[model samples]
Target: MLIPFLIMLREGIEAALIVGIIASYLVQSGRRHLIPAIWIGVLLAAALSLFAGAALQWLSAEFPQKQQEFFEGVVGLVAVAMLTSMVFWMKKSARTLKRRLQDSVEHAVHDHPGSGQGWALIGMVFLAVAREGLESIFFLLAIFQQSRDWAAPLGALAGILVSILIGYGLYSGGVRLDLRRFFRLTGMFILLVAAGLLAGVLRKFHEAGVWNHLQQVVFDLNDTLPMDSPLGTVLSGLFGYQAAPVLGEVIAYVLFLTISLACFLRASTPDTSAGAPTGTAMPAVTSPAASSPASNA
Candidate 1:
């Protein structure tokens, strides 16, 4: 549940931030007429996300046990791929995202600066919302395989809605946020989630007879962290906590977390300069009714 919630929170925040950035840019630049298109795009994307999530859940339950494992394994791998790319993409593009977004908007508007503003605006909103929405669906599906419960999805939805409120507050000048810190903290959690996904993928593979070796039983911790216990269930929801992890799962989780965290932590540092590319940035932000500020980070 924690994993789903956090992932959805982060994902929703990104989408909201993108929309906010675009909206703020337009308002600041006296392009308020473009607002309607953005709204349309945002709503459409949200609907699409809901549809996709429901569809995936419904479709997956139709599979046989073996097929379910296969499907789970495939989705797990894809989720890891998407999750890692998202983190690194943010690290690489966080700095330049604003500039790129700005430039793209400008180019679109200029190329067709008349009624075409609607199209350009819609494009911006669609891409921004859809990107996050699609990612969330994939991540949530991967998470569902582990917990096989409805709470995960409910938690994710709640997380995303809460994130919208947070993004709204930040965008409306209610609070100043250090996105770097936010991502760093969440990134740590994401790493843990990814590690669990990694172990899950391995489990699925083994169940499907993909990798047959390294199946020795590791010391069982079910006695200590019984899955039925509240703490255990919470941990399992968030970090894919295992009561009796097999040797491979244990090794995979540790190795992936150690290596991924090392690289992720090194890359997780926020850009202090807005001039930097996606992963590298000067961390400059435009505050509402105030001068642009550069974070010390």
Candidate 2:
């Protein structure tokens, strides 16, 4: 639930920021007429995400037990990779994201010069939102399958609600943000989630009979870490806790965390090389949409 909450929050903000950039740029350019198209794109994306999630859930219910576990494991692993990469990608390129989105929009609009809700603009917005929305479906579905708890979706809903408020505030110049700090903190928590998911993947492989590396129990602590206990539940919910993990599971988990965290830290630190920005993804300098004409410095 924690992992899903954070993933949704970050993804929600990214999509919102991109859409806000487009809408703000349109208004600033006196192309407010295109605002309708923007909202249309957002609505369509929402519909697609909802439809996909519902349909997938329905399909999963029809699967046999083992098949269901296999499918869930694969999807969960994919979600972990996607969400992890997304965080770091945003960390590395968020500063450029606005410019890229802006450039794409500008190019599309330019190609269709003197446009009134031009097909190009409509398609651009649709593609942007739909892409993120579909990604969200995968993350949500993966988490839902793993926890099998209703709270997972509810937690995601709450996270998104909070993120939307924060995103809107940033867009409207109602508040200043420390996005660098934000990403750093959440990124750390997510790293733990990835470690847990890695263990989960191994469990699935064992269940599928693909890996028989460690059939013996490493140790059993279920007596103390009973799933019914609050702390144990939290650990289980976020880290795929196993009362008795095999040697293979332990090795995979430790190696994954060590390598993943090292990579993340290496990425987060300042790079003195050419054109590497000092901050995480941030608002543009001197853009009409920015709160001030000056840069953050």
Candidate 3:
């Protein structure tokens, strides 16, 4: 439950930020008329994500045991890939995101005047929302499959509601968020979650009879900390804990965490090149739609 809540919160904030930034930019440049298009795009994206998730879940429910395992494995694989990419991409681009967005707005409004402008912005907003929405669906689906508890979905719903409040506060100039610290912390947690998903994917593949090597049990902790226990269930839901993990699962989990963490840390390090510091915490941004011209700065 906690895991799903946190993941959804992070993902929700991300989607809200993208839409907020774009909407802010449009208003700033005297293109307030296009604002409705942004909301339209958001609604369309939400509908699409809901449909896709429902379809996948329905299809998987009808599959045989082995086929179901294979489907789960494939979904987990995609979720891992998307989560990894999102972490790295945000780390790389968070600083420039606002500026690039503003630039894109300029191009969209100026390069193609009239109806084309609205379409361009709609497309931009649609893609942005859809990317985050789809990512959340896959990640949540993986969690839901494992935990199979009512709390998981409820937690996710709570997270989304809270994120919407936060997003609205930010937009209304009522909230100040240290986005840099937020992303950094969440990114680390997400990496751990992705590692667990990857391990789970491997197990699913084995269950589906796609791979059989390295199946020896590495350790057993059932007597001490069984996965079905209260604490064990929390850990399992959060980090994919196992009472008796296979050798392959252990190896894959360790290797993924090692390499991924190394890269993430290195990327986050303050660059000392040219005697100039880099990777400073981004200052809390004022409402981008605030009347004050310097609000965004």
Residue-pair clashes per prediction, in order, are 13, 2, 0
Worst 10 residues of 3 by lDDT: 288-297
Candidate 3 RMSD to the real structure: 2.2
Best model number under TM-score: 3
* TM-score of decoy 1: 0.88
Better of 2 and 3 by TM-score: 3
Off by over 4 Å in 3: 272-279, 282-297
Model 1 residue runs over 4 Å out of place are 148-150, 269-297
lDDT (tens digit, per residue) of candidate 3 on 1-297: 888888889888888877777777777677789999899899989998999899999999999999999999999999999999999998888767777877888888888888988888888888989999999899888888887769999999999999898877766677677777788899999999999999999999999999798999999999999997999887888788899999999998999999999999888886677463464544223355565321232
> Candidate 2, overall lDDT?
0.76
lDDT of 2 by residue, 167-258 (tens): 67666666566766777777877778878887888788678666778767788898978766898888888887888888888888899889
Each candidate: what lDDT? 0.78, 0.76, 0.84
Q: Is candidate 2 or candidate 3 better by lDDT?
A: 3
Better of 1 and 2 by lDDT: 1
Q: What lDDT, from 0 to 1, does candidate 1 have?
A: 0.78
Error of 3 at 256 (Å): 0.4
After aligning candidate 1 to the native by TM-score, how far in Å is the CA of 54 from where it should be?
2.7
lDDT of 1 by residue, 123-240 (tens): 7788788988888888888877676668887888899889888777766766566787677778777878888888989999888777777888888887777988999877777788
